[model samples]
Target chain A: MDPAKLLDILGNENRRKIIQLLANRPCYVSEISSRLGVGPKAIISHLGLLEQAGLIECSVDEQRRKYFNIANNMRLEVSVSPYSYTVTLHDVTFDRGKNEEDPVEKEIPPGEESSTLFLKLSSRLKELKKRQEELAQMQQQLQVEYTEAMDHCLDSIEEIARNPVECELLFELLKNETTLATLCYNLRLHPSIVNANLIGLTKRGFIEYGIKNNQYYWKIRETGVENE
Target chain B: MDPAKLLDILGNENRRKIIQLLANRPCYVSEISSRLGVGPKAIISHLGLLEQAGLIECSVDEQRRKYFNIANNMRLEVSVSPYSYTVTLHDVTFDRGKNEEDPVEKEIPPGEESSTLFLKLSSRLKELKKRQEELAQMQQQLQVEYTEAMDHCLDSIEEIARNPVECELLFELLKNETTLATLCYNLRLHPSIVNANLIGLTKRGFIEYGIKNNQYYWKIRETGVENE
Candidate 1:
């Protein structure tokens, strides 16, 4: 199973329980539905997700199909020690059914798969950036001017910067590991307006960024941004 | 915010990220959208869920109405001592808007609020049990029973005599820390099946229960439920 897909699937609480059910031993779908106390449809919904993640496999017996088995190549390791502990998080990927012939091995190192995935990821990112640039150039050639609500939202921000709810969310986004774009989108404002806020913060030296492919890694600074 | 509602809202990955975003300070919709690379519309959808959960609130500022803030009152108390430590696990609760005529004077015990909540919860359970029983009796009177699928979902002592998850959940319920309903709901199953599972396990002498309203205190036997 693609470790990335598995991670996304297991990221769900219901799917986690389904995986736990199969972890003990393989049982038929009906048995799982009974034990889990969920409708067959619900169980199947989660089961399909889990199966796609490569956490479990199924066997067909006559007309009745039973699911019983963990993926041999599945990598979910939890090592506990006094000082250091390791949890090799996995996610589902596109290439899943390829290595069914050779038994999958587990436990090499925590960052090994990530490094491998990153190598491919960087190349993909480059291709994506190139395509985005092409799109931008095409739009430019078409003399297309973007209509972003930057000025509209900036007017709103300046007027109600002290609004309790807005302030609270601003503070929260910085504290947690979330991106600025997430905050803006959640607020249903234009990306340009969000970019304006980022720019304001950048000028105030409260948020820093490094741009790559028209994307910025907005990092929080020690001093609060001078919205005022 | 209702901690339970917040929990449910944060329970999803996308929603959780939105909440995590607000952990720092207030921001607007556009910031959230661009940073996450998600469409502003999608982030708005998630924000709507968070708002309904009361984990978030929105504000209209001029032309650009920005969503910001969380409704929470609980604070975390982390106390560390030599060899032993106390950690206060509190979730924010909503309070009525009232005048504070007097200066803050008293210091209350940390667990006092939890105690009051529990007291209210017990009475609430009593009401629910009375209603559930009335419904159960009515169904019986009507000679109507749940489908075979539901009956099969009932906990089977024979099948899960040594199941680890059931044992852990039962132990917690018996300790007054939670209820079977909570366990079933969290596990994404019907509550009735949870009860049946408890009943089956209890009959096998693997667990013991003393019912108070609908809640039944269930615990493992002398040897205790085996982990493996």
Candidate 2:
């Protein structure tokens, strides 16, 4: 329900374009789809998010032609100066001076509410700036950690596979269960070579063997090592 | 950068919590990390995103302790109701009637600026509401289309791999490229069964074998089917 969430909904480029398209008038899904050159399915998802954010609303006619339009009674104002930036949104009706019964005690217009809120906000600007700095550092650290996490997985896989042949074998073992004869046949390698890779794979705990109908077959190990 | 980008930067719960913590006073990263019970690394990443959004700022003290504080001269306010929601931001100095040089002319306070903006906003509410309805219908259509697309893919995959085992094999191959022996070993199935699955897999063009250094290795086909 926070207005900040609206920004998240609009953060997407497609959503913003959708807003611009609907800014002046309402539009149907197919119309927007054709205009944007995107699949109707994707446009629907974006529109759903927008509606949830209260930026847009929808209706369906008897023919099942869905129409979309922007929400009403909402105001968004963003002003930025050299030293500071401010974003304020108001959907509540402000009847500050509308009650004229007390002319003797003139009521300041509802804009007074904003200035009061703004005063509180301005006072906290120093604090917000500090949070901004922390956020910047956090983003950098996340990118590094994300890369490290990915590299760690890849490195473990590479370690298990060791060589291209072993890698290919592990990759294949990852998919299907087969016997030594079948592996050798499909791999176009000697049974001895296939046996060597099989032994290595078994040692890595990546795979195990079983006998069915008096014939041996190999399959992925049941343990968590398969993920690696 | 667009201000909407800020929403994405602050969309994370951690970042929002960080903002609330920093709203009152400055604090070091370690302090925030310990309070939030998040690792320093994660906190650092969150701080980075907040900083990028310009919601907070930081400085390193002589003790090398980075102190974070909120930015100054900024205000963000959001209001929401069942029928509508509004977001307004102001970051500029309000000059009501600062200059006394001009006689006989009283400058309306800066709150007047908001009133004017609100009037403009009110006028556009009708247009926005229409857009909202259109957006809602678009979203519904999109959901149907998305489900339809997903169903189509599932139907195709099912048609190709009728058995559950074959389906599992296809799913795994979709992720990795492996050999017959390894596939048999990992899947814990008989080699003959693996060979049958391999035959089916090759037919579907999901995989292909190539000879490298006298050894045949299986790899995913280069075609876009790899994603499926």
Candidate 3:
């Protein structure tokens, strides 16, 4: 799904509340309306949009009453740091056929007591939760390290870059290796100015360029200074 | 920051593009406009909102040119599945005071070669990236386990619950232990109807209630069935 579209769908407070409510259990329009303390008409409209976006679905009961529930397993992750901004959406659907040896699939035995199954499942969930928390902590630590390193890189570039264009050239190169034409286009700078900065950066040992397909592609040197 | 507010800010493609641009390098208003192929007036407005939300900050250079850059280190995570929907915003700031023993902070010696420092930082970042990928895979597996367990729980409740209200009651109980008043409020059902469903569920051994602070709190029984 497009991150912008997903963000737009979730931007409304009522829509977010509806998703939260349905996350716990499926509900019909009236139940959702009353539970959310919103008008039924508004809830219906939100439901329509949610269903269209494939974020939710409806099932009809024997009485012809419709129940709405979450339809997809997905995650949206947005990270904004000094060094990078990224939005990633993952479709996390389970492929049971591919994971035939997964222990979770074989945990429940046929005709087993539902109570014991519940206990086992709940315990497994608790363990997963603990591990997730630990992973989250580790991820946080990594973010800190990333931010610190980027800050240091910026500081070093500030010392080496002689002008604003040179600064921008080095910063862009820090992200990835790219040719001069692409750099000019991305930075909205003239080709001559970008080329001059790239040459200067290479002389200062701040950046280097290699030939690919008969075009020069520039990138930040892993070891920033030369003759150290 | 509020998740809804964050979503609203990121919903605009231009604003998202602006952030993506700044993630590479800070840019002043005119530079941003030219790079994005947007008019200065509209870009300024977008920049204003971003600044107001504290997502971007501007610094004025000696030439009085204002450059905008990312202001915060944060992450927004939204998960949607059959059993849960959650939106969490994390402020991933570096608490240098708290993490005094962190090797990352101590690795860069003052006045050392910037080239060697950059190399070390880059290698450390690569290692962190590898670890993060491993953790992400583990997290995906955990989400699968959670969804499967919740599905199993729902199936068990369907077998035991005799009516819509009973099913709703059990679903609500599956989330956490709550009192009758809270359940009535959350479900938006009549007090008598909620009480009846709770009592029936308790009798059928699907749920159990305990007295706390002179009020009855109900929850799904770990062992769902009454008999072994």
Tens digit per residue, CA lDDT, model 1, A121-156:
233333443453353333222111110111122222
Best-fitting candidate, scored by DockQ = 3
Q: Following a full C-alpha superposition, what root-mean-square deviation does model 1 have from the true structure?
A: 21.7
- In the range A112-223, model 2's lDDT, one tens digit per residue, is 2332322232223324334534433343333233223222323334544667767556544533568888777655689888889888878756667999999898865654
Which lDDT values do the candidates have, in the order given? Answer: 0.44, 0.53, 0.77
Q: Candidate 1 i-RMS (Å)? A: 27.0
**What tens digits encode model 3's per-residue C-alpha lDDT throughout B75-128?**
887889877787877877555354456575466565546655654554555566
Candidate 2, position A81, lDDT: 24
Docking class of 2: incorrect
Q: Report per-prediction Cα RMSD to one decimal.
A: 21.7, 35.2, 4.3
Off by over 4 Å in 3: A33-45, A95-112, A160-166, A192-217, A221-228, B37-41, B95-112, B160-166, B192-217, B221-228
Off by over 4 Å in 2: A52-54, A61-63, A76-89, A92-228, B52-54, B75-228
Q: What is the full ranking by lDDT, best candidate first?
A: 3, 2, 1
Any idea how many clashes model 2 has? 92
Arranged by DockQ, best first: 3, 1, 2
True-vs-predicted CA distance for residue A88, candidate 1, Å: 12
Minimum summed lDDT over a 10-residue window in model 2 chain B is located at B77-86
